[model samples]
Target: MEFKKFKLIKQMQSTIKKEFIFLLFAAVITSSCRKIFNLPKEKEYLSNNVNFANKILEPVLGRTNLIGGFNGDNSTQPIHFEIVNARYGDGRPVTDIFQKAQTYVWTAAYTGTEKSLAEIEAKRHLEEHPLFEIRSSGEFIMWPSATNDLVTPRPADSTNYPQDTRFFDVKITNTGGERLIRDFQIRPWRERPYDPADDMNLYTGGPAPFPETPYNVLSRNYIRPSRMDNVVGDSTDIDLGNDNYHRNNVLVYIRPFTGGNGHSLRFKVLNKDSVAIDPALFNETEWVRLVHGFNLVKTKEYVQYDVAYPIPLVNLSTIYAPGGSNAYIELKYSRTGFGQQRVTTVLGLNFGIYRAGDWEIVFHFRKDNPRFKDE
Candidate 1:
């Protein structure tokens, strides 16, 4: 019995010794961890004072629009943002804004120097995403795929008023708390397909002239070696009687021409009688480097090119676009007058087309045929 008692005591001592060693090892590890890497305590900044500016968001359909109205105030970094309760102006729920959509995202870098449509398209990949999204950084993005069916546009007339609008609430949250900006107005506008857009009211879709640089087409006459007293400074300056050049004399129209596969662009100039003008007369035009197009075909009637859609593949200055924003088309011809003075008439237009299609731009000189003969 004494020996058994002594054995029990020995077993207890062994267990206690092992437990003490384990405790010591744990303590050493804990102390070393603190000494090796010291980290500051996480901060929780309350967003109670965080607010958004009272501004109406007007996103245009068929284009990507960025929303700006966030005022961080005293909010901390990494605040989360979400669109809550999206609805029409009449309080009807808007389910389309949250639905998944196939959106084109750039998979590879675009330097605006892509040689082919294949090269440009290969850099992009389509992925499913929401039509509208708000980032954690308070940046709101309305995807390009947002159409008229997805959201209501501003009414064009008083009869349609009070019915055409969209509304939503923004929810922002942080570790401190959450905030809701109530009844934020969203007045979406109809799609304006191309940039350098015509003067059109976004709310009413009515004719509204731009205050400055009203038109996109800049057509002017260039007179070299100084102008004579008898010679008119501009084509529009003097009345050519039947051949007068008015601001609206030339009518430019874009129509779909499905001749060159899917992506193609063609230019056609027509006289007052609707007869096709020889494109070769524009001698100063660089046929080879006219645009980012390949497989150029020139004829007496029209100039066709196998081009990548959107004229400029990207929104950067390249040989294709000198301004980096709009596609510029220049047509030029020079003729010597009575005094052997050189008169160069250069017609230029700065414009943009976003939709992908086989398209043709026709310039119709409505009043009279351009004088190409020397006096």
Candidate 2:
């Protein structure tokens, strides 16, 4: 028995020596890995990135663009998409005038003469114009590029549109039981550029600062279409007219309020909760007074103007076909901020998709009206 006890002690000593040696070796290897090989310790979570901020700062929330996606709200504004204004090709004045991102939605109609640009015609009004509705906030699973394996169209669901290079596909699960897959585009909004007419109007004498220098400030403002809301049956609906004899494709007018001494362009709210769906109600009643291409100031009392302008060549799809569903045309204006970003939502005027001409949906506010009022 005594001999057995002594043997047990010896065994314990041997085990202790082996464990101590192993621990010492492990310590040496771990310390050397960072210095000699620049490797993290075995227990450390491994990541390929040298800079760690990007990993921790993921899913950083920002403002959503028109197409129901997150917009690149950073400055040194890198523009990823193109709008076909005559002013687009000209160089933009880049400046950091805005500290945060901002968005503007300019609703325009192409007059018969102005529809010559190929860029305007290339997009089939509804198919090419992507619409998305984010009903709720959820995790956005991001895919790096359009052609990535993640974007492979589902085999069962054959309804597919050509990929928009401008956006990346990310999906979410809302509080409701619906799953939303949206294309999130990241783009920087630029400052409103100076027009040659501005020389005649804005500055008769100020030396036109070259685009990259002082005159052109990189604008953080952007405007986009609104998210598609399955719940809001009447939201994002714009009216089109039916004047068969005179096929005026798109019509926008600001006629003086008829039969009333006082002129008011007051707006009414229509949504999922409205009493009854209003018919395509654009006529002399829905005239939009525009203050052409003016920047808006945000305050408790917002400002707008009213004026008459020529309408543009209209390209609207047949929305009210027998089996078709009424699509929404909500425009979302976003203002990025250090804290919560400011957002303004504009619902499209509901109109009959089948026949539209003379039928005018009133845009509540005008972009270029000469007269101004605060409300």
Candidate 3:
């Protein structure tokens, strides 16, 4: 009886061990299957590539305004300037309009040093006779007469207007020889009462303000791209008319008048017309079809680094403009000072335009400073 009981107990123990082994094997197989089947999130994986494109393209084509307008008074009309064309050395058009607009703003804000013709000639002769090249082309003709008499406080009420200030109608044509036209309405800087505490200052406040003037500089028009129909792609058939392509993600560094200080800046990005392509379309199986249908430039990555923060992931999108399509992206950034103070120096805006494929740097500086200079 004892021998039989021992054998039975041993058999039961063997059965339990076999069941444990089977359960362990099942768990391992389940885990392995999960690992094989799990797919990565699409947007996350592609987001890095998108960001890489932005970093590469932002400085090249992303930091200036294409068109901007400023109105000093509500009773009077605002002054407007448009950028007609901007391009790179390789002849490919830099399509961001915002960069062109910021360039105009920087030009308007510049204040040049006054000198006699003899002094100018002396400096020109001494300063290595800089090659005279029209960095940009087309007409920058001023609109509206410079001597238009507008509303102002009476002389007895205010001694501000010693003489009627001039307003010039200006146009900038063929910016950088890309065959485009930019127009501007230039006027003398008029000083009006400005209170920092006023809510109306956000739009048309100081230096020139109406009763509605607020505490800050009133923004006349938000920077934007042109809606003209002809702006399509890189094709020659699109008639590169007086209308120019605009982009707004280029960064500029400029020197201020009073502080002798410099600031780094970028414009805002507003409108983009390209669709984000899915990465799945580039599957190996679809390679033959992709090659047959689209002119596929192997997907490249663009990246950018933020100057502030713990350095989080900065994502950016790339719009593919077919050979002849008007392709552009806009990005806006305010000026930053060393101490984080918003410097009121208006003249410190600068812009550089470059191509996306090439890694070159194109710097566009203001030729003349309108506000401080009498010329």
Candidate 4:
């Protein structure tokens, strides 16, 4: 028994020597790696004179809008922000801007690759949110359900559109210190979401004149019928309509058809004869990833979606609206033409419908059917 005890002690000593040698080798390797890499220590950043470039904010009501123009010069990441002294245009103290209401919030990450309603619901949740909020990144946000006419007076009449304003100060802070940006102006406008004219007049709440751009290809009446001409052996000879056809064309608008049973949006297309067009023909469109909707239902008549209200839940540009602040839907198809050449055409629109309902947007080809035949 004593011999066995001595043997056990020797075995322990051997094990300890091996472990000590391994640890020493590991320490040397780590030190050498650190020295060879010449890694610098991370420097802590503090915010310096942070200012917002867009001191004048003009957010429309009834939609989620992010207020940008954060000019944080030499500021650390994730700078904290708080709204201070929120009041009306006349400097009266207000609390409506801070009141909470039901709003949609993302629970999981939306990677824009979700395939079904189950996936979308898993990523989103409804929560109560303030009317206006300042995020930690020194940006402001106006929630979807915010509507305070007292702070932002509505137009008395169509001709009497007003630019009632509100004033507030922002308290910006970081690990370094805090600074107050005083007298920031907010001139809220009524909901004028989406557009062929993307920018609505702040004074008129109507279509604003198109901004000067050499590449502006958009039109207010984009979904109009093609003009017809009687030319033999020409594709333009397809008798869609005369030039005056747009005056009596089929109407395209959004209206509720579900009696407000659920939050739903639908789309439909019709030929010149007022007959439904098969949605499957738009082969180049992404139905699943279209418009951030879920539970897609395609039929002979229309394509429907179970969507949250205000068409676009937020005004920011996303996969649903690549240009941001507008809802864009692009439909495309291709056909084999003469000489076996494939021809492709893309038709798109950027528009918005702010009111929540069981809405359906119809596109009726009143003049002529889209030419799909080969020469």
lDDT of 1 by residue, 15-93 (tens): 9999999999998888778778884445778556676665477787766666766887877777888888887767778
**lDDT of each residue in 64-114, candidate 4, tens digit only:** 778887788877666778899977666678676788888778877765556
Which pairs of residues clash in candidate 4, taking residues 3 or more apart in a chain or in different chains? 317-324
Q: Which TM-score value belongs to model 1? A: 0.72
The TM-scores of all predictions, comma-separated, are 0.72, 0.17, 0.15, 0.64
Candidates 1 and 2 compared: the better one by lDDT is 1
lDDT of 2 at 365: 22
TM-score, cand. 3 vs. native: 0.15
Backbone collisions counted per model: 0, 40, 73, 1
What are the lDDT scores of the predictions, listed in order?
Answer: 0.69, 0.26, 0.24, 0.66
Worst 10 residues of 4 by lDDT: 225-234
Question: Among these predicted structures, which one has the highest lDDT?
Answer: 1
Off by over 4 Å in 4: 1-48, 75-80, 148-163, 173-178, 193-255, 259-261, 272-275, 280-296, 308-328, 334-340, 351-356
lDDT of 2 by residue, 1-375 (tens): 999999999999999999999999998888877799887544422122211111111111121222223333221222222211111112332122112222212245433222223433343232211122222222232211111122222222232223311333333222222223233333222111111111111121223333334445432111111221111112222221222113222212222334322212212222222221121221112122221112222222222222111111122333211122232323222232225643232234222212111122233222211111111
Mind sharing the TM-score for model 2? Answer: 0.17
Instruction: Report how far off residue 124 is in candidate 1 (Å).
Output: 0.8
